[model samples]
Target: MHIYSSHVLVCSGTSCTSKKSPELIKKLEEGIKRKKLDEKIQVITTSCFGLCAEGPIVVVYPEGAIYSNVTLNDIDEIINEHLVKGRIVKRLLSGNNEGNNSYESADFFKKQVRIALRNCGVINPEIIEEYIAYDGYQALGKVLTTMTPEQVIDKVLDSGLRGRGGAGFPTGRKWLFAANAKGDKKYVCCNADEGDPGAFMDRSILEGDPHSIIEAMAIAAYGIGSDQGYIYVRAEYPIAVKRLNIAIDQAKELGLLGDKIFGTDFSFNLELRLGAGAFVCGEETALMTSIEGKRGEPRPRPPFPANKGLFQKPTILNNVETLSNIPIIILKGADWFKTIGTKKSPGTKVFAIGGKINNTGLVEIPMGTTLREVIYDIGGGIPNGKKFKAAQTGGPSGGCIPTEHLDVPIEYDTLIELGSMMGSGGLIIMDEDNCMVDIAKFFLEFSVDESCGKCPPCRIGTKRMYGILKRITEGKGEEGDIETLEELAETIQAAALCGLGKTSPNPVLSTLRYFRHEYEEHIVNKKCSAGVCKELLDYIIIPNDCMGCTKCIKVCPTKAITGKIKEPHIIDQEECIKCGACLEACPFGAIIRK
Candidate 1:
């Protein structure tokens, strides 16, 4: 085996790739070669470190010094000082410390418990050997050789691991249902079609540790007595798709997949099916429908996917995050898995944290971790000293969590009780400046656009709700608009055909429940206190504060402000467009948004 004195791990995930980590890799390799240290040093590409905001990241091993925001110019110093001289570059190091910074030492990583993201930022994903060295396929081998099919299912049931794909369904129960359902041919499937806004948990797993998913699927197939499987992922995730295809080819070459694994009687084959970027395909039945080469639309449930799915065969569908945990559970025993998280909700959850927070990245914490910790401890609180107002979880199909509920534990049942849900783990923080009514309108608009038009509740009901929200934000809201929205939300939640339709009104309903005053203010008082609704705002020149600065007048597109150079300006309200251009142009805090 080849041994290196030192290794440099560069982040190659989509976030880091976009920030030129690939180019940084090329430069590092060239620099290492130029310095005649190529033999002693190894340069490898890994996936996200979860601290996406700190990319492009480079971690030097043996010492494990993380270098954040790396550029092409920083390569020479890293190769020379760290690789050759054995001196850590303090200037390029991640974290606020002047001394040492490693994986466990970093603040952002302190609260996180990486299970699904364990291999990410650690192993070179494209290389199958790297994954193998870390005991990648050991779980599959164990399941195939040691454990019986029923035992495997029973172990999962004992683990208390719920599905990480937002619905929080029992993973073992789903597998058992598929196993018990009498079918001549049963199929195992992985749902990598993550369509939530600002959510990339599935994509990261696919990119960083594709082999894990393959191993788990094989284990599941063995348990369920299935010989064929399919993975439905969006084509938009080109990196993930490429890595997954590579992993599959590698597994087949090693006899881990395809005919008779480990020379046993079991035989399983896998295939990939790409979606056309349909958000509704995230639903189980819709995903199966899409996989069958049909339009991605939800089918009403009498027979769930376990009984009749994937071309009318008994099938079990698990999302990428859920499947990633299976191999670990098999290898590390159910008891060990159950010890990590809350009793009801065992194991950790990966959250894609974004918007208004200081640290915008991906975080995986235990299920019962409070919103306060996620926002303050891990996320570094809201940016620019702004007070945190609300947090929106579960994307468009979920609800908003106001400041009052910041202390609430972020479990599935707890979130549901608070009128929100654990929808695919997209946590968007909002500051004091955010208008809750506007935020609700934003999510409703997304639902309106993504709706498949399959049922009236989602098709027409969500559209009507969106129109009402739009009117409220634009200063055209009627007095009874809030009541109408509430009525519509109730109807949609009750009568919608599928999960997507039923949950489409969640954002609107939750916002109204917690921030009803914001809506009433927008409608009754014709004002936006947060200064977000431009149509409801009237920018006024504070006469005493205005020092006759013509900056506002010069920058105004509408030419609404007019004044002599030495005198306070007068804004022509009739001509003003509420574009906030004058507000921004004002230097002395003279223009106030009301």
Candidate 2:
């Protein structure tokens, strides 16, 4: 292997790809070839660079010169100035205009501790050699050649790593249960079925470092004495699925995944299972059932997957984010891994921060990082000068953390204590414009639609809760509706069979816990404080502020606005529809929602 003079890493993550990073890559390659520098310059397509806001991003190493929002037209200048002449592109570089000079100076990358996402923007995911060059499969080699199955389990136990898949269960304990199960045939499963609304941590890891998950699965197979493994990924993630297939084929070709792996007696093989976009299938039992070619539905516990799973054999399932960290834990040693994070939660967590935030992208920080840091510092604070209202973490199954709990350390126990579980690490920030009652209703509606309906508590309880929330948002809520919603939430939580049904009430429960005042305003005052619930809001024209602009009339879909030039507008109350088009179109800010 020869070292190249320079490496140009272009982010091919979904966010950057949407911004035409692929075309930028092509232009870079063509320009390098046109300059007769292909031999010296290596252009690579890597995973997300974390700063998705500034993409299509290109980082040239080993100088670490960061270019934000690069285009195909800029490729020539970059090649002529930076790549060939070895000068930095000051205009394209990220960070403030004054102080900092390099990529590290950017506030986004400075605060982030990329553990699960370390290799995301650094290496070419499609190339197996690059993965190996970065100490990728070295953990599997170490585990296969030296460490016994018991030793592997003990190391994970000592590391204090819990599942990143939201349950926060000790990973080593789950592995031990499967290893101890009395069965002739056992299996290792990777749950890549990430269905959380705002979450892309799993998909990014899979797309950027599929080899990590593959290698981790192999090590898990060795630890649990399983000869077969399956990765149940959602079909929505076509790029991740495609790359995972490539990584698996490459692994098999290199004699890393087939019979007599690395000259050891252990034989492990992996297969792909595509999910039909069922959110309920994210649950372990439902995922196993889907893998077994059956309708995805959660079954009763006690006969957990460790005892009876996937063709009635003992099975261990870990999500993609959870598996991605396995290789590092093994290679770095348990004690070394344990020293980085909180005492109990010993690893980094990847969060998909979206909604009302300035910097919306995938962020991986240490486990004990505060919500304030994630929301204010890392997320660049809320957008549009809007006050921070609340943050919905952990997806539909997770709960909301209000502004009061912003100081909470984002650990598994701390979030759970505040009525939110770390479900796949999706932290959606809400601003003052967002209505808490409507937000809860929106998540409950999602839960109701995704429920498998196999269990009565989840099916009926979710429907009842959603109905109560709907009535509240639609201005039909009664005084006792809040009490009724709480009751239904409790029932669904206690009686539901699987994780999906049990945690379905999280959105409602958490909102009620923190933003009960919002619910009270909806039910008692018949008003939406955020002015989001259209049914409870009335659009009025302020004559003093109105410049008699007819712009609102032209844009109204319902033709509800009646006004002439140099005259105040009048909205037909019955035909208004509460669309707020007038409110948006008014130049003088005359239209107001009350």
Candidate 3:
């Protein structure tokens, strides 16, 4: 075995890779060789460090000194000053201040408690040996060697792990149902079709820690008494799919995946199933249908997947994030896992925080962490000093959380109580500039488009709701439109065939529940309060503020702003396209949308 005096861990996660961390890696290697420290020092590329705002991160082990925002130029300095001389590089170190103590006191990592993300930035995901070094397959070994299927299910049941994939169903109970179902040919399915917008928590896990999911699936297969497993990953995530394939190949080569037993009687095999980018397939039945080479549509449930699943046999399905937690729960013991979060919702949740936030990336926090903590402390509050208006959780099937609920604990029940859900953990922050009605319409449009046309409630009902939202946003809303929306939302919620239809009204319903005043303004006053819906807005020139720079006139596509240089500009309302190019192009505070 090759032994090194020190190890250089560089982040090769998607965010860092986009920032050229791979090139940075090459530079470090050349620098190490040039300094004649190649034998003594080792460089390893790993996964996300979570502090993505400071990307291209490097951490030196045996000293645990973390460096942020590293470039090719800084590589030589790190190699010469730190690797050879055994000194810390001051400039590259993280934290608010600049010293050894400062790096340790960094605010970025101080409050975080890594459980699901523990192995993310620590090991090479493609290499099984490195995974083994980090005790990757230890859980599988323990389960296969000692525990029975019933015993394994019991352990998970005691762990208090609910499914992280939107619905928050108890994972152990799901497994138990499949285990009890008497079927000669049972299977395990992994829901990797992460269709939610801005939700890449599952994708990151697949990219950075593919082996974890693979191992967890093996554990689940054993628990569910299944010999075959299929991972239904979306085709959109090429990187994640590539890494997942690599991990599966590596695991199979190591005798961990294919008809292999780790030398036990248990034998399980896994395969990849690609999705054709249908958002509706995020639902289990729809995902199964897609995997079976059929149109992605949800079937009626009662004989749920546990009773009659893949190939019409008993099957257990768990999402990527839920599977990611399985090995850890089994390895550490259920009691150990249960101690982390709230009693009902134990364990950590990975949230993809994006849209109008300062720190836009994946975050793993305990289930009970407050929205204020996630938005203010971790997300760095709303960007550019804008007041936080609301947050949209659960993508199209979820609701908007108003500012009043910022302090609410972010568990499954809490969010549902507030008219949102823990739907796949896509927490999108919205600032004061966002219009509530427009936001609802935007999500409804997505829901309408993604509806599989299988159920009338989801297909036609969402379309009708979206049309109403469109009319309201366009200043053509009637006084009865609000009541109509409410009636339609309730009808859809009660009558929809699957979860996709049932939860499709969430955005409209929640926005109406919380921000009805905005709707009233758009309908009764014929004005969009946030000035987002273009049809209800008219861009006018504020003559007092206009500098007459003619920049807006030159940039306007419709020649709306007509004025000579050095004089106040005037907007020709008849020619105005309402594209807001003038508003965006105006350097001065000249253009006002009213």
TM-score of every model versus the real structure: 0.84, 0.83, 0.82
Query: lDDT at 361 for candidate 3?
Result: 78
On TM-score, the stronger of 2 and 3 is 2
Q: What is the Å distance of residue 468 in model 1 from its true position?
A: 0.8
On residues 221-246, what C-alpha lDDT tens digit does candidate 2 reach at each position? 99999999999999999999999999
> In order, how many clashes per candidate?
0, 0, 0
Which portions of model 2 miss their true places by more than 4 Å? 1-104, 549-567
Candidate 3 lDDT, 470-503, residue by residue in tens = 9988889999999999999999999999998999
Model 3: ten consecutive residues of lowest lDDT:
102-111
Ranking, TM-score, top scorer first: 1, 2, 3
Provide the lDDT at 23 for model 1: 99
Highest TM-score against the true fold, candidate:
1
Model 1 error, position 45 (Å) = 41
